[model samples]
Target: MRRATSLLCFLIVMLCGTVAMAASPVNADGYYKGIKLCGRVKVVEHFADIKVKVVDSFPDLRVKVVSSFPDDVGEWQFVEYGEDFTVQFVESFPDIKIKYVNSFPGVE
Candidate 1:
Protein backbone atom coordinates (compact mmCIF):
# COMPACT_ATOMS: atom_id res chain seq x y z
CA MET A 1 0.00 0.00 0.00
CA ARG A 2 2.90 2.40 0.68
CA ARG A 3 4.34 1.80 -2.81
CA ALA A 4 0.97 2.40 -4.40
CA THR A 5 0.63 5.70 -2.47
CA SER A 6 4.04 6.86 -3.66
CA LEU A 7 3.15 6.13 -7.27
CA LEU A 8 -0.07 8.08 -6.93
CA CYS A 9 1.80 11.06 -5.50
CA PHE A 10 4.26 11.02 -8.38
CA LEU A 11 1.46 10.99 -10.91
CA ILE A 12 -0.26 13.87 -9.19
CA VAL A 13 2.94 15.92 -9.18
CA MET A 14 3.55 15.28 -12.86
CA LEU A 15 0.03 16.29 -13.74
CA CYS A 16 0.30 19.51 -11.79
CA GLY A 17 3.59 20.40 -13.40
CA THR A 18 2.22 19.91 -16.88
CA VAL A 19 -0.82 22.01 -16.16
CA ALA A 20 1.26 24.84 -14.72
CA MET A 21 3.55 24.86 -17.74
CA ALA A 22 0.70 25.22 -20.20
CA ALA A 23 0.78 28.48 -22.14
CA SER A 24 -2.27 30.59 -23.00
CA PRO A 25 -2.28 33.08 -25.87
CA VAL A 26 -3.88 35.70 -23.71
CA ASN A 27 -5.06 36.19 -20.17
CA ALA A 28 -8.73 35.79 -19.27
CA ASP A 29 -8.96 39.49 -18.35
CA GLY A 30 -7.93 40.66 -21.87
CA TYR A 31 -4.24 41.07 -21.32
CA TYR A 32 -1.38 39.47 -23.16
CA LYS A 33 1.39 38.23 -20.91
CA GLY A 34 0.40 40.81 -18.31
CA ILE A 35 0.63 43.73 -20.76
CA LYS A 36 -2.53 45.64 -21.51
CA LEU A 37 -3.53 45.56 -25.17
CA CYS A 38 -4.50 49.20 -25.34
CA GLY A 39 -2.18 52.22 -25.63
CA ARG A 40 0.75 53.43 -27.64
CA VAL A 41 2.52 50.71 -29.54
CA LYS A 42 5.83 50.84 -31.27
CA VAL A 43 7.11 48.72 -34.10
CA VAL A 44 10.61 47.37 -33.70
CA GLU A 45 13.02 45.48 -35.84
CA HIS A 46 14.17 43.11 -33.14
CA PHE A 47 13.88 42.21 -29.47
CA ALA A 48 10.18 42.96 -29.42
CA ASP A 49 7.89 42.10 -26.53
CA ILE A 50 5.43 40.53 -28.95
CA LYS A 51 5.68 39.07 -32.42
CA VAL A 52 2.59 39.77 -34.49
CA LYS A 53 1.15 38.70 -37.79
CA VAL A 54 -1.43 40.78 -39.62
CA VAL A 55 -4.21 38.74 -41.09
CA ASP A 56 -6.92 39.78 -43.45
CA SER A 57 -9.53 37.76 -41.56
CA PHE A 58 -10.01 35.32 -38.71
CA PRO A 59 -7.63 37.10 -36.38
CA ASP A 60 -7.06 36.61 -32.67
CA LEU A 61 -7.67 40.31 -32.16
CA ARG A 62 -9.11 43.17 -34.16
CA VAL A 63 -6.85 46.21 -33.87
CA LYS A 64 -7.80 49.80 -34.56
CA VAL A 65 -5.04 52.33 -34.86
CA VAL A 66 -5.97 55.54 -33.18
CA SER A 67 -4.33 58.89 -32.73
CA SER A 68 -4.89 59.10 -28.98
CA PHE A 69 -6.64 57.66 -25.97
CA PRO A 70 -6.12 54.00 -26.57
CA ASP A 71 -7.97 52.92 -23.48
CA ASP A 72 -9.67 49.76 -24.58
CA VAL A 73 -8.76 46.34 -25.83
CA GLY A 74 -7.17 46.30 -29.32
CA GLU A 75 -6.99 50.09 -29.43
CA TRP A 76 -3.45 51.10 -30.26
CA GLN A 77 -1.76 54.28 -31.34
CA PHE A 78 1.45 54.13 -33.30
CA VAL A 79 4.26 56.03 -31.73
CA GLU A 80 7.93 56.55 -32.29
CA TYR A 81 8.92 56.22 -28.63
CA GLY A 82 7.54 55.95 -25.11
CA GLU A 83 5.44 53.03 -26.12
CA ASP A 84 3.34 50.85 -23.88
CA PHE A 85 4.51 47.79 -25.79
CA THR A 86 6.68 46.93 -28.73
CA VAL A 87 5.82 44.55 -31.52
CA GLN A 88 7.75 42.91 -34.30
CA PHE A 89 5.87 41.96 -37.42
CA VAL A 90 6.57 38.53 -38.77
CA GLU A 91 5.11 36.51 -41.57
CA SER A 92 5.34 33.29 -39.63
CA PHE A 93 5.53 32.05 -36.05
CA PRO A 94 3.76 35.02 -34.50
CA ASP A 95 2.89 35.36 -30.84
CA ILE A 96 -0.52 36.69 -31.82
CA LYS A 97 -2.40 37.27 -35.04
CA ILE A 98 -4.31 40.52 -35.63
CA LYS A 99 -6.53 42.12 -38.18
CA TYR A 100 -6.77 45.81 -38.92
CA VAL A 101 -10.31 47.06 -38.47
CA ASN A 102 -11.86 50.46 -38.83
CA SER A 103 -14.52 49.96 -36.16
CA PHE A 104 -15.49 47.84 -33.17
CA PRO A 105 -11.99 46.67 -32.41
CA GLY A 106 -11.30 44.23 -29.61
CA VAL A 107 -10.14 40.76 -28.85
CA GLU A 108 -11.88 38.16 -30.95
Candidate 2:
Protein backbone atom coordinates (compact mmCIF):
# COMPACT_ATOMS: atom_id res chain seq x y z
CA MET A 1 0.00 0.00 0.00
CA ARG A 2 2.87 2.42 0.83
CA ARG A 3 4.60 1.71 -2.49
CA ALA A 4 1.35 2.31 -4.37
CA THR A 5 0.89 5.67 -2.63
CA SER A 6 4.44 6.74 -3.58
CA LEU A 7 3.83 5.84 -7.23
CA LEU A 8 0.57 7.76 -7.27
CA CYS A 9 2.25 10.84 -5.78
CA PHE A 10 4.97 10.73 -8.44
CA LEU A 11 2.39 10.50 -11.21
CA ILE A 12 0.48 13.48 -9.83
CA VAL A 13 3.62 15.63 -9.69
CA MET A 14 4.52 14.76 -13.30
CA LEU A 15 1.00 15.57 -14.48
CA CYS A 16 1.08 18.94 -12.75
CA GLY A 17 4.39 19.84 -14.39
CA THR A 18 3.01 18.93 -17.80
CA VAL A 19 0.00 21.13 -17.29
CA ALA A 20 2.17 24.14 -16.41
CA MET A 21 4.39 23.77 -19.49
CA ALA A 22 1.39 23.32 -21.78
CA ALA A 23 -0.06 26.65 -20.66
CA SER A 24 2.65 28.75 -22.37
CA PRO A 25 2.48 29.34 -26.13
CA VAL A 26 6.04 30.62 -26.45
CA ASN A 27 8.24 28.46 -28.62
CA ALA A 28 11.28 28.70 -30.90
CA ASP A 29 9.18 29.14 -34.07
CA GLY A 30 6.58 31.34 -32.37
CA TYR A 31 3.76 29.32 -33.77
CA TYR A 32 0.78 28.13 -31.76
CA LYS A 33 -0.83 25.03 -33.19
CA GLY A 34 0.48 25.90 -36.71
CA ILE A 35 -0.90 29.44 -36.52
CA LYS A 36 1.86 32.00 -36.93
CA LEU A 37 1.87 34.52 -34.12
CA CYS A 38 2.49 37.43 -36.51
CA GLY A 39 0.79 38.86 -39.58
CA ARG A 40 -2.44 40.60 -40.53
CA VAL A 41 -5.04 40.24 -37.81
CA LYS A 42 -8.71 41.00 -37.71
CA VAL A 43 -10.67 41.89 -34.63
CA VAL A 44 -14.10 40.34 -34.34
CA GLU A 45 -16.90 40.30 -31.87
CA HIS A 46 -17.39 36.57 -32.10
CA PHE A 47 -16.18 33.37 -33.80
CA ALA A 48 -12.51 34.32 -33.80
CA ASP A 49 -9.58 32.09 -34.52
CA ILE A 50 -7.81 33.28 -31.41
CA LYS A 51 -9.16 34.81 -28.24
CA VAL A 52 -6.88 37.38 -26.57
CA LYS A 53 -7.04 39.26 -23.35
CA VAL A 54 -5.25 42.56 -22.80
CA VAL A 55 -3.21 42.55 -19.64
CA ASP A 56 -0.94 45.18 -18.17
CA SER A 57 1.49 42.65 -16.72
CA PHE A 58 2.61 39.05 -17.18
CA PRO A 59 1.56 38.94 -20.79
CA ASP A 60 2.03 35.77 -22.73
CA LEU A 61 2.81 37.83 -25.84
CA ARG A 62 3.82 41.44 -26.34
CA VAL A 63 1.92 42.59 -29.41
CA LYS A 64 2.84 45.51 -31.62
CA VAL A 65 0.44 46.96 -34.15
CA VAL A 66 2.17 47.73 -37.42
CA SER A 67 1.11 49.29 -40.68
CA SER A 68 2.78 46.60 -42.75
CA PHE A 69 5.22 43.74 -42.77
CA PRO A 70 4.08 41.99 -39.64
CA ASP A 71 6.70 39.33 -40.10
CA ASP A 72 8.13 39.27 -36.63
CA VAL A 73 6.49 37.41 -33.80
CA GLY A 74 3.72 39.41 -32.04
CA GLU A 75 3.65 42.07 -34.78
CA TRP A 76 0.11 42.46 -36.07
CA GLN A 77 -1.39 44.50 -38.86
CA PHE A 78 -5.05 45.27 -38.53
CA VAL A 79 -7.04 44.33 -41.59
CA GLU A 80 -10.62 44.69 -42.62
CA TYR A 81 -10.64 41.51 -44.65
CA GLY A 82 -8.30 38.76 -45.84
CA GLU A 83 -6.61 38.54 -42.50
CA ASP A 84 -4.09 35.92 -41.59
CA PHE A 85 -6.01 35.26 -38.41
CA THR A 86 -8.95 36.70 -36.52
CA VAL A 87 -8.94 37.55 -32.83
CA GLN A 88 -11.52 38.40 -30.24
CA PHE A 89 -10.90 40.51 -27.18
CA VAL A 90 -12.38 39.20 -23.98
CA GLU A 91 -12.32 40.23 -20.35
CA SER A 92 -11.85 36.69 -19.14
CA PHE A 93 -10.86 33.19 -20.33
CA PRO A 94 -8.59 34.29 -23.16
CA ASP A 95 -6.74 31.79 -25.26
CA ILE A 96 -3.68 34.01 -25.03
CA LYS A 97 -3.05 37.01 -22.85
CA ILE A 98 -1.29 39.94 -24.57
CA LYS A 99 0.29 43.23 -23.64
CA TYR A 100 0.30 45.99 -26.24
CA VAL A 101 3.74 47.46 -26.77
CA ASN A 102 5.15 50.04 -29.10
CA SER A 103 8.27 47.97 -29.76
CA PHE A 104 9.99 44.70 -28.95
CA PRO A 105 7.06 42.48 -29.81
CA GLY A 106 7.34 38.76 -29.17
CA VAL A 107 6.23 35.90 -26.99
CA GLU A 108 7.28 36.11 -23.38
Candidate 3:
Protein backbone atom coordinates (compact mmCIF):
# COMPACT_ATOMS: atom_id res chain seq x y z
CA MET A 1 0.00 0.00 0.00
CA ARG A 2 2.77 2.46 0.87
CA ARG A 3 4.57 1.73 -2.39
CA ALA A 4 1.41 2.31 -4.36
CA THR A 5 0.79 5.63 -2.60
CA SER A 6 4.33 6.82 -3.35
CA LEU A 7 3.96 5.87 -6.99
CA LEU A 8 0.72 7.76 -7.23
CA CYS A 9 2.30 10.87 -5.75
CA PHE A 10 5.19 10.71 -8.17
CA LEU A 11 2.84 10.36 -11.10
CA ILE A 12 0.81 13.32 -9.95
CA VAL A 13 3.91 15.47 -9.66
CA MET A 14 5.08 14.49 -13.12
CA LEU A 15 1.69 15.21 -14.62
CA CYS A 16 1.65 18.70 -13.07
CA GLY A 17 5.15 19.37 -14.34
CA THR A 18 4.19 18.41 -17.87
CA VAL A 19 1.17 20.70 -17.81
CA ALA A 20 3.24 23.61 -16.53
CA MET A 21 5.90 23.15 -19.17
CA ALA A 22 3.31 23.03 -21.92
CA ALA A 23 1.71 26.21 -20.62
CA SER A 24 5.03 28.02 -20.42
CA PRO A 25 5.44 30.97 -22.81
CA VAL A 26 7.80 31.31 -25.75
CA ASN A 27 11.27 32.45 -24.78
CA ALA A 28 12.33 35.74 -26.42
CA ASP A 29 14.56 38.64 -25.41
CA GLY A 30 12.22 41.27 -26.82
CA TYR A 31 10.10 42.33 -29.76
CA TYR A 32 11.55 43.59 -33.05
CA LYS A 33 10.67 44.49 -36.64
CA GLY A 34 12.03 43.72 -40.16
CA ILE A 35 13.42 40.28 -39.36
CA LYS A 36 10.14 38.34 -39.49
CA LEU A 37 11.82 35.74 -37.34
CA CYS A 38 12.10 35.27 -33.61
CA GLY A 39 15.60 36.08 -32.37
CA ARG A 40 15.40 33.57 -29.58
CA VAL A 41 14.27 30.72 -31.79
CA LYS A 42 17.10 28.25 -32.11
CA VAL A 43 17.81 26.75 -35.49
CA VAL A 44 16.76 23.14 -35.26
CA GLU A 45 18.66 20.24 -36.75
CA HIS A 46 15.47 19.58 -38.72
CA PHE A 47 13.67 22.60 -40.12
CA ALA A 48 9.92 22.88 -39.64
CA ASP A 49 7.78 25.57 -41.27
CA ILE A 50 5.64 27.76 -38.96
CA LYS A 51 2.85 30.23 -39.81
CA VAL A 52 1.68 33.14 -37.59
CA LYS A 53 -0.30 36.39 -37.66
CA VAL A 54 -0.49 39.67 -35.76
CA VAL A 55 -3.94 40.59 -34.57
CA ASP A 56 -5.31 43.90 -33.26
CA SER A 57 -6.35 42.63 -29.83
CA PHE A 58 -6.30 39.58 -27.59
CA PRO A 59 -9.44 37.39 -27.34
CA ASP A 60 -10.45 39.47 -30.36
CA LEU A 61 -11.47 36.74 -32.81
CA ARG A 62 -7.85 35.70 -33.44
CA VAL A 63 -6.75 32.13 -32.91
CA LYS A 64 -3.48 31.30 -31.23
CA VAL A 65 -0.61 31.17 -33.73
CA VAL A 66 0.99 28.05 -32.29
CA SER A 67 -2.23 26.04 -32.37
CA SER A 68 -2.74 26.69 -36.08
CA PHE A 69 0.69 25.33 -37.04
CA PRO A 70 1.48 21.69 -36.48
CA ASP A 71 5.23 21.80 -37.08
CA ASP A 72 6.33 25.05 -35.45
CA VAL A 73 3.68 25.19 -32.79
CA GLY A 74 5.24 26.20 -29.46
CA GLU A 75 4.66 28.32 -26.39
CA TRP A 76 4.68 32.11 -26.92
CA GLN A 77 5.85 34.53 -24.27
CA PHE A 78 4.37 38.00 -24.76
CA VAL A 79 6.50 40.83 -23.36
CA GLU A 80 6.36 44.59 -22.88
CA TYR A 81 7.80 46.87 -25.60
CA GLY A 82 11.38 48.11 -25.41
CA GLU A 83 14.11 49.59 -27.62
CA ASP A 84 16.50 47.59 -29.81
CA PHE A 85 14.10 45.04 -31.22
CA THR A 86 13.32 43.35 -34.55
CA VAL A 87 9.98 42.04 -35.90
CA GLN A 88 8.94 38.80 -37.59
CA PHE A 89 5.64 37.58 -39.02
CA VAL A 90 3.95 34.24 -39.33
CA GLU A 91 2.27 33.98 -42.74
CA SER A 92 -0.80 31.83 -41.99
CA PHE A 93 -1.66 32.21 -38.29
CA PRO A 94 -3.23 35.54 -37.22
CA ASP A 95 -2.45 36.04 -33.55
CA ILE A 96 -0.30 39.03 -32.63
CA LYS A 97 2.97 38.09 -30.96
CA ILE A 98 4.55 41.46 -30.25
CA LYS A 99 2.74 44.57 -29.06
CA TYR A 100 4.37 47.99 -29.44
CA VAL A 101 3.77 51.30 -27.73
CA ASN A 102 4.35 53.87 -30.51
CA SER A 103 3.54 52.11 -33.77
CA PHE A 104 2.87 48.64 -35.14
CA PRO A 105 6.05 46.86 -36.14
CA GLY A 106 6.47 45.28 -39.58
CA VAL A 107 6.37 41.49 -39.95
CA GLU A 108 7.66 39.63 -42.99
Q: Show how many residue pairs clash in every candidate, following the order shown.
A: 0, 0, 13
Tens digit of lDDT per residue, candidate 3, span 29-64?
222222223222322222323223444543111122
Q: Write the per-residue lDDT of candidate 2 for residues 1-108, one digit (tens) a residue.
A: 999999999999999978866678666567777898999999999999889999999787899999999999999999999899999999988888899999899987
Q: Which sections of candidate 2 miss by over 4 Å?
A: 1-22
lDDT tens digits, residues 1-108, model 1?
A: 999999999999999876643444755455888888889999999999999999997677789999999999989999999999999999999998889999998876
Alpha-carbon TM-score of each model against the true structure: 0.75, 0.77, 0.29
Q: Hey, what RMSD does candidate 2 come out at?
A: 4.9
Most lDDT-accurate candidate: 2
Q: What order do candidates take by lDDT, descending?
A: 2, 1, 3
Looking at candidate 2, what is the lDDT of residue 46? Answer: 96
TM-score between model 3 and native: 0.29
Candidate 2, which ten residues in sequence have the lowest lDDT sum?
20-29
Off by over 4 Å in 3: 27-108
> Considering every candidate listed, which one attains the maximal TM-score?
2
Candidate 3 differs from the real structure by a C-alpha RMSD in angstroms, to one decimal, of 13.2
Clashing pairs in 1: none
